[model samples]
Target: MSQNAVVDGAANAVDTQKGDYPDFMLKEIHEQPRVLRETFAGRFDAESGRLKLDELPLSTDEIKAIERIYIIACGTSYHAGIVGKDMIEKSARIPVEVQIASEFSYRSPVFPPNTVAIAISQSGETGDTMDAIAIAKKAGTPVITITNVAGSSMTKESIATLQVLADQEVSIAATKSYTGQLAHLAMLSLYLGQERGMLSADEVADAMAELEQIPAQVESILSETSIASIEAAAAGCYKAHDVIFIGRGVGTATCLEAALKLKETSYVHGEGYAANEFRHGPIAMIDAEAATPVVAIAMESETRERMLTIMGEVKAYGANLVALATEGDARAAELADHVIYLPQIREMYLPFTAIVALQVFSRQIALLLGRDIDHPRGLVKAVVD
Candidate 1:
């Protein structure tokens, strides 16, 4: 579809509500906490310790029978899958693989019988993703889709669908839908874990409680203080030629998405690398005089020490260092030139808080650079064939 066609379709969907928002992107970004809430509403029962994800095509028996899982997506959806791969493998004890949709559609990958293929797409019309889903369906593999649009091609073609309904998500760059997709994946992971006997019902109930608190924690990140700090970080990025983000564990997915947000909106040459991966050889490229911005995800986790260690390495290079630290992480504060403090949460949900900080920082960077925050130059909302 053409850009104007997509915009017109989105505009027509919410034309009556357009006046309610300042900028489409900002409105969508701020709506994420609510989107997370709505995405999981009534889908989890803490008291019953049951996940009401019957909407998924597979039953408990089929879920447990599955030998492996493949998640196919593109762009931000692919990042969500990186996080989802961890969620499923840890909770469900399933060997999961995430593939870029365009590549998967062309690669002729093999899967075992009962392998489940999940396609994650916000628009549901991502051409490459849809093509991959078609291939899975043709092979008689059960196909499930998580999509924002109820009537999209992806939803209709799937055996079952997890409808995120993340509002219209009209902005060229995604915001609310990304978080919404994460919420759906979390619920799916918990559900599969309980059904597959990897997690006790009681344990899943406890985790569900934590999932419920994510939105409030995210709301806390949207405070005046948080926005002010992000603006400060953005100031340093105004003339930056390169911005590098690094993290570990699930935080690696956080780093990738965060840097992508900066590049997507600000057109800064941003890249995200695993902290250890950067140490291997990429570290030598860092130079103190470049004033290069190197943002580190030093949030509390098992990998906290390693992330801090990598941050210190970057610090030695005399690059402009910024850390996204947890509320009481004094070590992270001491390690970097600037710190964006997030509320203390478990490592699994750190991406939720960390990604919001990245989005705010990227938005401020675009605004400061006088670039189009919503419809950035030379970018389209979706790469539909």
Candidate 2:
């Protein structure tokens, strides 16, 4: 379908209500804490410190028999799969391949015995994902789906379904749904890990304890003080025609989603690159004259110092530098032209809090540019085809 057709169809098809909030996107962004809570509820056993995904039909033996996993989705869901890939591999000791559903449908991929396919979609009706699920089923793989809507097409096709419980996301650019997917992915990874004997009860408990705090941390990010800082950061870059987002490790997936949000809402050219990959060629685009903004995810991690070095290079090139740093990082504050401080959490979990800032930043920039933040032009809530 053409972009113009998509825009026209979205106008008539989706709900554009803002209610008490100024825009649907912002409303969805603020609803993330509740979304996270709902997604995690009844999915964990506090007494045993293990995940209880009774909804998942795969037994312990079935999970243990899994040799490989395929995560198929597109756009934001694909980025969520990237985060899931790392977490599942570390926790479940299983290899995972994250694929774009549209591409995967065309490729003659091999599905080894005992393999499973996880299909992620905010709307269970996404056409490419549904097609990919059909392929997986044909290959005799059990399909598990993570989605917002219960009993949707994807759910009907899958052996088991994990509902993200995000409710109705009215905005074309998804906010809470993406977070909901992450929350479910986190739980599913832990569930698989414990069932497969890769993670102990104590380890699961420690992770769950940290995960439980994410809702509160995200709520803090939506606070007035945090919103003001994010607005100020957005103000610094809203005029740019192009923006660059860079991160390492799981932060890289966060960068990809953040960049997509910016582009989708504001009609700006936003690109995400791995921090080290920036120097390969993208760094040359950073010019003093253009003042291209480089948003760096410089949170506390093993690669933080390297991130700092890259920030120094960006500054040397005279590009505006925006950093998402851990709370109370003096070095990051000094190095950045604008800083959105994220709550102190382990690097793996930082995506929950850090992406909130970028979501607000993208919305603020859209508002500043007088763009429709809720239903962005040429975009739909779901791309069925």
Candidate 3:
């Protein structure tokens, strides 16, 4: 047997070796709230009006001088970039572009002067992401890396690096690392916004304080009643032939990551789309027989009403709508065929909670379908290419 199999067998034999945890997925899932809390601790200083990112390689002036931002990442990190793009653009008033590492490296895109490339990866050793960073460096763009692993390739290659502090993640499907990435990126956006004079001291301080509480709130959500509701939804999805995930704004990235989890583990046909984009062409694919299983992210934002309207359309078309919304969102609850109540987090942080629900949903679906949650077919923990 392989070394990994030997370790798995040994872990199964000793209850103590597992440390009272069932699996890596469960342990990692439970760690999200705590990881999020630790990420914000000591990082934000209200009095100085500066977000003190310990061990970051870039100076305030360098960050402020950045004229363009390019985020390159793979898998879940890429999803985080999608949310980060929105955060940076809105908060810092900077134009940002996010690209998958594999595509970005090979596509030979033009990089302008004064462009700051942010490379994100959990392992930091993803060959494709590292290659993309190398390409950016060769093209004379400064590189900043956000990574979980401290001494990995991406961290070493970039001019500046911010660690995600998620520690070790054993599950092939990422959980805590995804949230950790969000926390770090959110803080980065806040810092950059302040430096660029796009955000006021009051705004940055308020956001920082609210973010510091996210880990506790996320922990409560996992331990609260929502876990069971998410599991049941996952069980229903296991038998479905296809699943559709929908959201607007930042939630769109959450939808993409959710679909990715389902597709990666359950070997099901899953697609994630912006709720507005659904009307453009995807709606024609929906019907009663083999009806698509829809997971909707209905957060309290400017897009909330529009998201609910899209959910109504999904339900009207006979699609099974499983809506995740904050507590007391009566309209979302009314339209949803199934409802999972999540805690109210910052709009930028909503993706972190929504992703937890997706992780639970995907894992349960994999279990009900008898697929290996840690080792899905035709996939490795790291996509090197």
TM-score of each: 0.94, 0.95, 0.92
Q: Which 10-residue span in candidate 3 carries the lowest summed lDDT?
A: 1-10
Candidate 3 has an lDDT of 0.81
Candidate 3 stretches greater than 4 Å from native: 1-17
TM-score for candidate 1, residues paired by index: 0.94
Q: Clash totals for all models, in order?
A: 0, 0, 0
Q: Better model by TM-score, 1 or 2? A: 2
Clashing pairs in 2: none
**Error of model 1, residue 57, in angstroms:** 3.3
Give the lowest summed-lDDT range of ten residues in model 2. 1-10
The top-ranked prediction according to lDDT is: 2
Q: Is candidate 2 or candidate 3 better by TM-score?
A: 2
Candidate 3 is scored at a TM of 0.92
Cα lDDT tens digits for candidate 1, 46-120: 667687776764667878898989999999999999999999998999999999999996678887898888899
lDDT of 3 at 286: 79
Better of 2 and 3 by lDDT: 2
lDDT of 2 by residue, 273-308 (tens): 999998998899887898999999999998999999
